[model samples]
Target: MSNPTVTAAQANKTPVLVAICLAAIILPLSFVSGSIATPVISRELGGSAQALSWITNAFMLSFGCFLMAAGALADEIGRKKVFIIGVSLFALFSGLIGFSSSLIWIDLMRAAQGVAAAAALAGGSASLAQEFEGRAQMRAFSMLGTSFGVGLAFGPFLAGLLIAHFGWRAVFLSSMVIALLSLSVAVTRLNESKNPNAAGIDWPGTVLFTAMLALLTWGLMEIPSKGTTSVEVLGLLGATVVLLILFVAVERKVRHPMLDLSLFRYARFIGVQALPLSTAFAFVVLLVLLPMQFIGITGMNEEQAGLMMMALSLPMLIIPMFAALLTHWISAGLVCTLGLVISAIGLGWLSQAIASQDMFAALAPMALIGIGIGLPWGLMDGLSISVVPKERAGMATGIFSTTRVAGEGIALAIVGAMLAGFVGQGIQQLSLAKDSHTASLAVQRLATGDLHQALLELPSTNALQLTAIYASAFQHLLLWLAAITLISAAIVFAALCLKTVPTEVSETLCEPDQ
Candidate 1:
């Protein structure tokens, strides 16, 4: 078999590079479709707040769990072959989601879609890195970053429009179109990157890793709904810990580990991983909390809030190209770290915003946050793969992709818990302040449904008191977000400040088989 080669004159492979970027773009874009549909689905299915979040978590848990295995498979099989299979499954299941009438069906479909997405995403990034070296990789990566930002940015607005005009079902319908286009381009232009001589798949490592991630993600998702003491959540967490420990032991013994734990030996590799994980943690929290705050506290409709929040997405498109250019002259670590700090500032600013604050004022902070997303989104993988041998690109990309999804899942659970706690404390304070007769009624209204309805029924005599309490509660929640964002910023700084050397070399440093 002859290898497909690029010549000096036939070097116009921008289409292939764009297609690779598009493949990555499609994975996250489809993820947003379900994420933004949660609130709308809740209305349709009489779903609980807990259920709204599970829709996102269900997808993330599956995607994160199987990512490492997907990467390993890409190396064992072939990148192009795995890419096509993943996208076909993704598109098929994504369309089925639109027709789902019940919550259980939707959750099941979402999980399957996640499994398929992990394959496409893992292979897509590895193929891109393998196909384009040095300057070309940088440019293609920068574009990919912009697309990543764009997909997330567009998701809310798309969902909002579909919900307002056609209903939530339209969100899934749109995914079918995007998935088809992505699948078509991938099938036509993408080439394989597998080495036939690479060792067979690490079946033991794959099973253990998937189990560890799934259990942990499930535990995290359950925490806000079941409370920290719930027997089920505790048992899941315990099992996850045990499985994770077992996974580490197994990986050490496997000849060709799915994750290649040895990559941590390189400081650059560690930094690259941290850049995305921390940024994703902070970023996803902002994505989830802001719309909730705007809708719940500010009396804005979902569409209005989603559109206004597009500020976060706009910067994602602009900043990554600059990051690519910066890497041409400066350390990639420094560039990524700077992006994280800027994003932290944005999240801090967001946490400080008051209810009904002007959109422009909020956008000021969001601009910095968008830039932060751009930096890491644009450069982290390029930097990480640059340091590793070509053969290990699939595994490296998989690990990074897994971490990214896991970080988002963890943020969702933790932040959801924080928000519920804040609201619960406020309810307690509100109830305690009322007369004994009114206390029961107040608690009932708050618990029944429709927080606004509960607020409206408060006697005029107690109106001011209840309003003050709600205001205090909202402020406390914002403060908590600010603190978390600041902590994430600190971590990004610490990771980026470490020394690292960058090179445009081939499959040499940190070989996969080592």
Candidate 2:
């Protein structure tokens, strides 16, 4: 016999799930779309490299910093309320981005969109968790992961089409339309839920933590240009440490904490945290680096490079769904471990193929890397809160989301800086550049894929010479990344596979083979 209450709950879940996925598309869409449209934006508005950088950096900064606070707010307030408002604000800011005549105005709007993205993610994910449980919950989060992958998979193509036909403004306006459509669907069907015990925001913790993230991210960004030891970089990083200590001390003493510090005790939780960090090293960094290598070194145009990336991102859309099924046969921990191993293999393969500068030879390795990344992406979110009591789902999502997003920013910065150093060293060995200063300037321009300008910085060098330097330097970088990814996999195994867990986590992580 079917219960009416259960039937109604089941019906409600589908609409809410669709809405969240639709809203999820806006963040990554904005990023890739903006990247494809940057030249168009710059021509009309006029921006120096630093000013243009704020187009994405501002968004990431606000988004990463506010994730935990927004999560706490959703739990303290109502998840449904937060979701609706956040998506609505996202639509509004995205639309505003289209109307801006100045780069600064667009930067401000993008920053606001980031805050909205953080809220929408935290609230929507927690709400989704509340709508389902156990295997059903795992499936729902898999769909969430799929939506994110779908965005990355097609973002460049979609943005290119929109920018070519209707101009760059169409990209943001189209995202706004999706957000509005998502809100309309969710408002009627979504249920309101929150933690009864959740209290007001922890003012001290919120401020300190946000400032800490802002400083840390901004400091990392400074490293590529300013060097690690610059006063600006050193000061910001020093302040970040002080803020972190203060946030921890405040959260411990607060009666109603913004974050529950005790959840860190679980080994599964630690493993879940490591998952995003691993992906950042193995996959996220490549998203940017590959485009540069293809366009700047391999002599592909933007469109061709974007098309080549499809081999890397396309599997993300389906492999995550497959991973969910694989976990039913093996422990999720083992699944992630194997995924990292696969990516390490792909990285090594790519290093070898990349030297040939043949796009076709790179396809298989790129797709392999995508499949490897998708495995953990599919399960990490479900595993995040599953290890904790249901009551703390909001906090769990916040912590995990913050770690994932912030870790990406850090990886990009550190890897970018390291690559510049390697390229500089390679150019010096070539003995074509006039001096160290000329080599440094060439490295800076080449790092950003401004090959024409980079060539200008080295008058004695031809395209072949500069790209050869990059190919050799890039090969070494890929090998280093492969080694790091394998190490991260071992760390993940030590945390999740080495220890025995309770029944809830056991179901989440492990299943006996048939």
Candidate 3:
């Protein structure tokens, strides 16, 4: 016999789920869409390379720094209130970004948009956890994952279409429209949810965490251009270390910590948390690097490159639905481990194929990577939230989300350094055969990632040889990326191997002090 109370709750869940999914879609959409439009923005505004990088870095820095505090606030105040505020602010800032006359204004607005995203993401995930439980919780998280995948998969395609027809501003304008629509749905359908007995915010812990993230991210962003040994880079790294130590000390003493330190005791939780970092390092970094390869190595236009990426993105959209089903038969931990292994294999294959310089040969590896990445996409959020209490959903999701953003930033910096090092070495070797000035100029064009420009600057006879040199350097970089990804998989697998004492989700959600 069906219970009327259970039936009523199920019926109300649908609208709330829709609103949460929309919120999930909006944040990633804003991120990837901006990435696609960045070149056009730089061209139109006449911004320097350093200033242009800030357009994206500013958003990432603030977004990552604010996530922990925002999540705690959602648990303390109300998810509905935070979600609505985030959506509204996101819309306002996104629209303002489109109207900016200078690069500085755009960077400032993008930073504001990041803060708004942290709020919406934390609040939305917590709300969904509060509204559903058990199998229903798994389904809700799967749908949320699907929405996130869709945003990332189609973001480039949509941005290319809009920028080609309506100009780059249209990309931000479109985001504004989506945010507004999500805001309206949220206001109408979402219910206020928070921990009734939640303690006050841990201001000291929050400040220390935010400062540590900001300094760390700023230093990472600067490393590619300034090199690792620069005074500014060393200073930021030193400051970040001090803040991280301070943050740990404060969290231990705080009555209500921004991040509960005891959560790390569970090996299962640690394994689940590592998924975002692995995915970001392996997949998100590729998303940034591959477009450059397509344009610089293959001489593909922006539209063509965006379309080609569909080979990678399409599988991510399709595979997650099956991941849920697979987990029913296979343990979620084993499923995640398999996904990581497959991703490493795919990346390894791609490194070999980069030397071939055949577009068709690249597609198969790209598709394999997409499938491998997608398998874990559906499982990560569900598993992370399941281990913790519903009340702590915001904190868990905040930490998960932070790893992703920070991982991407760190991966880019690491890969950038490798690429620069290898390419410089390749150019130096090539200069022994040709005039040093011409070789250096050709390599400089290659570094810009503009194939057409490199081709135009070099003699036809030399173009093919110079391209081969660049391609060889790129292949080496891919090998390093693949190695790092494989290492991450091994770490996750080892973590999951540890024996863990099972506890009820409800029991886990109780106050840390209790």
Candidate 4:
């Protein structure tokens, strides 16, 4: 006979689970919509290209950097409390950003929004770990992933509709409603959790790590304009390295490290880390880049560009579930590796299709990329902590979330710099403008799809020539992305399936419980 107490406990978890899922939906929806809203925001606010970039960068940077700190704080104090606080602040900041007239105010609020996101994701996911166990836990986390998938799948189209009718501010403001809902649900339904013996956080390490990331990102952002070899860029990069070494030293010595550095010792854990970073470079970067390509370069309107992006994100809704089911039949590592391979193939196909200058032709490859990425994307949250012991799951979840979001932010910046650099080189080679300064201006304008302004700056070039060069640069970038994805697939497969590993490790890594 079933005990009433046990049945009651199980029933109570449902509302808490729903709240966590809602929180999951809020951030990813914000991420995609913010990208979709960027150009429109730029048009209205009239900021310089450098300042305009903060719309995405500021949020990602703060969100990425503070994840570990937030997770640690959650463990020490209370998970549900931190989560509620984070969601509430995110809603407030979204409203502030939406209403602000100045770029500086908007950017500051965006950064604050990111910190809140970090707290919510880290606290909420960790709380999820506490609420469920074993295979049930995996399914619950899968629901979490699906929530993220839902946001990615529908965010663009929704943002487009909102932009078309209510204006771009809706993109930011829309997230407020979601956040408030998630917050209210969490406040009421979720039970607070904490670690009894958890030590204090390593504030010094946290500060250094955040600073290192900020410096590295700033250096990358400067690369397109200042050139990689510029004194300022070099100094920032150097400082970044120094800070990283110091952060490592502090983490090694700290009584309570933000990330348990030794977690990297497990081959499977290392492989799991690669999964998020791979998806970041291969999938997340494209989320930002593809929409810009569709809207800026090809002159598609918001709705049209959002529709084009559907081919890229729509598969996410279904493919991740398919991937989860397939793991029961085959090694999870193999499935993820295969997904990366498919995505690499899609990237190559995309590059080739770009040569045709046909948007519709590119759709199939975009879908292919989405389908491929969905496999790995679905499994990441589960795999992140499965390799580690339950006792360490909070730190594991924190580190994994940090890697995924931070990697996305860093990859986006790097790819942006590379694309701009490629366009700059193409401009000089094509002699689009004789003056170096004029060519630089044209490169900046072209990168943002301000082709009209670019042509005005480079009077010598016609529309056809600039378009061809842009296409060529884009093609090369896609190929590079494809190559990186392929290499990561091999590494992840090798690490996860290593025969030298212990039997228990191998079973967990390759044959996750379905």
Candidate 5:
């Protein structure tokens, strides 16, 4: 017969679990809808390429920058209180985004939405950790992962349908309804939880960390336009390094540190942390790039492109349900390592298929990528929090979420820079080969993703050559991405294979503070 204590504990956990899962679903829905609507928004507002990029980057940057501080605040004050505020702000800003007539206003609104998301994510994850333990905790986190996967899987398709029927404004406006639903559930169900003994917020450390990330991201985004060595880029890069050093120094000395450096001593924690960064650099970045390719290269309409993306998103929804079962049979570390390896192979396959430029040939590889990503997507959140004491759940969730979003943001900047550089070089080379100024201008237009304009301007002879050049440049970019992904897989494998017993690792992670 079940113990009364254990039974009562689980009964109490049920509502909290539901509330966190609902909150988890909201942020990804917001992000993916914005991604799907980017092209339409850009055209309608007559925004520049940089402005278009900012629409997405602004959200990611603010979300990542504030996560640690939000996490610390949740621990210091109360998770439920912070979460309610976050949901309300997310709903408000999301509605404001839909009404904006200018790209600048939209970007500002997106950044504010991201800040709200940070608070909700950190607080919700912490609340889950506080309410569950051991196998129950694993199941709870897996459910949260499944909810996130569901959001990603349906976000684009839903956004497409909304945009098709009601226009791009519908995409942002739709989030308001979701936010209100989540907010109501949270208020009714979630128990207030916090670390009562946790000290005051470390404002200095927070400022330094935020400044470092902002500078690093700005420098990366400027690389394509200003060149790596330009004064603006170099100054930002140098300042980022200095701020990082200062942030580390402050965290080390603070009584209530924002990030606990001691957590890095556990090899298991290190391995789990790498999961987000590597996966985001490879999988999340591809999700963004592939949709653009579908529209620009394959001549697919928005709805068709969103449908094709299902080849990548559907498996994410289905496979996360199996995470707990898989963990029972295999170590979480081994599972994550295998996932990374599979993702690398899938990326290589995708590179080849993209070079072929046959839409049908790409679908199978897209499914492979989906399976690869899905394998570890569910396990990562569980592993990240499980390795730490319950009291520090907010900190663990913050680091995990920060790395996840920051990795995606950084990868996007790097990939954008690389694509622009490759296309520019390809255009210059083709111009010299053809010896026609008109052909050069046409290729330049293609490089900027104005494929229709480029085709209109190109002479028949130059059109074929320019298309070939563009394809070659794209193939080269994908190959580089694949190589980076494989290297990340190797690193994950090595980290997880360290010599340590499972019990010893657990003790190291969960030992009480000195």
Candidate 6:
């Protein structure tokens, strides 16, 4: 009576390749668009740089804050339903953003987009995890990484082309198109995957946690644009600190915490979680800081600088193909640690090349940084989800995304502060140079471009002297970044030693719940 051919494979639903493509379309657009679209939008509306910044920051803050709650919701309500809701909300707000005339409207819509993105993003990884297992799971994770990288790599360049051809409105409109298409596919193709036994949404904890993240992120964003000493800025920072404490207290008392405070009990979970956080921090800081250095100090034009910046994404695109293959034999921890070490080396090498203005020479080190970023980041989702219960994959994925965005925001604040400090030092050194009068003139001219401005400002009689001063000061920034990269390497290495690789534990952890 039994059908011999009815293996799990025969019963399994055919994987929807379109879903991955749909996910790829929406995954990193919000991030790339949020950061990349601001300047054009601000200029068109005659808004301050600060207003442009808030447009991006508002989205990041809300997106990061709600991720955990979205994950919890996905688990309770079903990923298919939650994803549809997120997509619909995302499309509606994205349309609002495209036509908005006011800066306030743009910021609010961006925030709404963030909320929708949080839900969609949280479920994306979980959907893949639930749909596939064993070799299939590995393939799904690898493909998921590729999808994410494609979104990230393409987002800015795509936005640039659209903005140039169609204007800033095109960027938001594109998101809407992708969101609607994805939503349609998901509704028709994806099945419900809700765990009835999973804990319900933790409203109190979610509110407190989101409040804490928002306060902290807002305060961090202020440090760059508004000096740290400003009364209002300091007040925000103080509020963030207090809210964080309260958030922790609330989580401990909550029956179902949005963030499971007890997850830290697993040393492995802590390490896996920390890897994504640090990797995101390092990558974001480098992305923000490096392009300015190339444009300001190395004298690349905007387009040239943007192209050079592609070196970061290049390795990300290629390394994962090899990385996915390696994962079958290599422990995820080893691969991730190797990635971190390689990135540190690349950044360290980049530090040494600061004395040279050649962009070609800079490429090698930067390409290495890209390789480093791709390897670990690619493995992170798999490693994190593999450790948690299958029923809780949505929640875990949500926390992973939250940490990632939070790290990104934190990196922006930290690196922005460091860059300001470096520039200030460069100015001071230029001012204090022996040929002070001529150097001051050149420093003023630095608004044009680093190399040419320095060349122009230095007296023909003292050209060499001034050039040396500029190079010396610029190298200091390089040295500082190099040091930070090494420090990051050490942190990663320590985390690796403290945690076991997932392959060793995957079987035990992946055992289906009774």
- Top-scoring candidate (TM-score): 4
lDDT assessment of candidate 4: 0.86
Indicate whether candidate 1 or candidate 2 has the larger TM-score. 2
lDDT by residue for model 4 over 419-513, one digit each (tens)? 88888988888666878778777887777666767787888778888888888888889999999999999998998766545454436556655
Q: What is the TM-score of each candidate against the true structure?
A: 0.84, 0.90, 0.88, 0.96, 0.90, 0.81
lDDT (Cα, tens digit) per residue for candidate 1, span 34-152: 65566557667855555556677777778887777777788779887877888788888878988889888888898898889888776776677677877667666666766777788
lDDT of each: 0.67, 0.80, 0.75, 0.86, 0.76, 0.66
Per-residue error at 395 for model 6, in Å? 4.7
Model 4, residue 414: what's the lDDT?
91
Query: What shift in Å separates residue 424 of candidate 4 from its native position after superposition?
Result: 1.0
Give the Å shift of residue 471 in candidate 1: 6.2
> Candidate 3 on 430-478: residue-level lDDT in tens?
5532564554444545653544455555654456776676778778887
- Top lDDT prediction, candidate number: 4
Off by over 4 Å in 5: 1-16, 132-135, 386-394, 432-448, 452-467, 500-503, 507-514
- Per-residue lDDT of model 2, residues 1-514, tens digit only: 9889987877768888899999887777777666666655755786554565567667777888788888888988999999998999999998999877889999899889989998998889879878888777777777777789988888777876786678879989999999999999889988899989777788888898888888887787766556777899899999999999998999899897877899887777888889998898888777767866765567665566668888888888888888778876888888988999999999999988877766689899999999898888887877787766776666787788888887776777667777877777787787867876676667776665556667888888888877777777777888889998999898888877775655545445654333
Give candidate 5's error at residue 130 in angstroms: 3.3
- Ranking the candidates on TM-score from highest down gives 4, 2, 5, 3, 1, 6
Give the range where candidate 3 is weakest over 10 consecutive residues by summed lDDT.
Answer: 505-514
Clashes of 6: 0
Better of 3 and 4 by TM-score: 4
Which lDDT value does model 5 have at 345? Answer: 78
| Model 2: CA > 4 A from native | 1-9, 39-46, 132-138, 296-299, 389-393, 430-440, 500-514
Candidates 1 and 5 compared: the better one by lDDT is 5
For candidate 6, the TM-score is: 0.81
